[model samples]
Target: MRGWGPRAAGRRRRLRFDGWIAGLGTASGTRLVVGHWPRSPFGPFSDVMAEHPDGQRVLLAPTRETADFIRRTYSFDAVRVVPVAVRHAGRTWTVTAGPLDLRFTTGRRGPLGLLLRAVPGPLASRPLWSALTDRPARLLMPGVRTRGTAGRGRREWYGARDLHPVVGVTATWQGADLGGLAPVSPPVRFGFGSAPRAPSLTRITTTVEVGAGEEDRAG
Candidate 1:
């Protein structure tokens, strides 16, 4: 999910973010339900509910392109993660989307960079240049802005899901056999799509590796 935060005084950052949300919702054929962080701490889930009074969708957080956030938090495993190389705006990028969130990376980072990607949670933001340099960061915005990364430690299980599709990218499935799970998301099971007539998921994992030139032959 992409995010955009508030901008300088008298700027239309929020409006710009709303436009993005609307566009994404149209493209995805579903509302991009966003988690909202309230200015005041929530007693419980009140923050989320308040932000999404109509439903479970709200304003953007603070991010630019998928590239803005997908650089790290690498190595995710779910039911299935299909990877492919994509070309856009004269650039080649690797896009990977799993159960929790979609990720993008250039695969140029090695040990230290790789370690940062594995930094677990918000803690990944810690030590980031954005969190340090404020003056130069503001130039990226229309006016003054606050920039930084906040991270906790790491956590296991980036996500788990039966099936995931990234529009024009790839498809994947996990323990759910790509939709064999008993119950799908509530909106899906009860709202629009039809459940599988009969889904049988055997808890099994099979790994296949194809060499540089043996892909077709192996298949």
Candidate 2:
């Protein structure tokens, strides 16, 4: 794998999405966490687990709605949102997204440089490779830091054992303000475009579902 292909990657090994809730955390730089998974049927702990490479994880919810969604989606016992004001440089940066501090930072440059440098080749390299191989050769190799692949370490906190699928709920939340430093928008509503692509949490039943077969399989 060379880089982020315009098409979504296979396996959904890591639940990465298109856009993220963008805001500055108490940390030094602006942090942007993905707001939705480009693929469907994303699970709790999947999104945050994907970001372990960057050394950051979501710790709180940004709004009441977001909090409720997390609980309903993953059947978490409870959740708490902490608000803090962080000072950077000589100036104080107000928390914009309130308790739900979205994660964002200056990461790596995307595939622009590599894509532009892709060379046109075909007949010349034919002796050694066929058209099938040549096309891939023209493409850039995937970044070393891409979400999931061989050699990448697993996140310390969450995993498949922790995954619990819900019909219309998710663990993601919109971080609104940062310790009164900055103000962020509310969580994406059920039908609103702001919501994740997973599903609409309009009437999520809080009752937990326990499948005896699943429990037996685990045992």
Candidate 3:
């Protein structure tokens, strides 16, 4: 982790979330990244990061608390606190969040997934390991990063454990069909980095380090 000011480094709290992140783009020019965290400081919850063709970024969270926490950790043009539900069966995932209803299927793990699985989870999730892999992550997946500065004086590390390509998708936004699945074309402008351009599902452990002052509000 990069050092901030002395006071900030001295008084900081680390929070971790372990879960699956699915990124995909629809032919209608809408890109969506769904984070379904089954473990976190605030318990299990899921959030959606969406970017429209017009470049409008929106965050759909399950509650006001989750929405606030996400907004503080990332940038968004609009936010909606709604009932976000995610259900998965085997390789298929179904998601319903406010105006969006999406279903996607994952294929067999690719070469990168195989490589990621070889790394021990404990060693891979370490901040030092994340920093060491940052450059390689960028080279392997353009627009993706392992470590970056988050919002509100916070730094974050993305530790990936597994990955699978998204092979199919059918989605709708506000009842209109979003067309077929496509690559995450223009990359999302939510935080310091975007999801992989190839459209896939990644199992990740996200660690966010926040100063003492921000910690109080983050909770």
User: What tens digits encode model 2's per-residue C-alpha lDDT throughout 1-219?
Assistant: 122112222422221122222222221221223232222122221122111213333434444444443433332223454432222222111222333323222222234323322423222222222223323423432111111111112111101001111121112135323221111123222111122222111101011112222211100
User: lDDT of each structure?
Assistant: 0.20, 0.24, 0.89
**lDDT tens digits by residue: candidate 1, 1-219:** 222222222321110111000001212222222121121111111000001112332222223222111112111111121222222232122222232231111223334334434544343222233234335434432222223221111111111011112122221212121211122122211111111121111111111111233112110
Give RMSD to native, each candidate: 21.7, 16.9, 3.9
Best by TM-score: 3
Between candidates 1 and 3, the one scoring higher on TM-score is 3
Query: How do the predictions measure up, each by TM-score?
Result: 0.18, 0.23, 0.94
Which scores better on TM-score, 2 or 3? Answer: 3
TM-score (C-alpha) between model 2 and the true structure: 0.23
Q: After superposition, how far is residue 16 of candidate 3 from its true place, in Å?
A: 0.2
At residue 156, candidate 2 shows an lDDT of 10
Candidates 1 and 2 compared: the better one by TM-score is 2
Off by over 4 Å in 2: 1-32, 43-56, 59-98, 101-144, 147-219
Error of 3 at 51 (Å): 0.3
Task: Assess the local accuracy of residue 86 in candidate 1 as a C-alpha lDDT between 0 and 100.
Answer: 20
| Model 2 residue 82 distance off true place after TM-score fit, in angstroms | 11
Worst 10 residues of 3 by lDDT: 1-10
Taking the tens digit of each residue's C-alpha lDDT, what string does model 3 give over 1-219? Answer: 122212234678777778899999989889999999887766778999999999999999998888988899899999999999999999999999999999999999989999999999998877888999999999988999999999987899999999999999999999999999999999999999999999899999888887777634332
Rank order (by lDDT, best first):
3, 2, 1
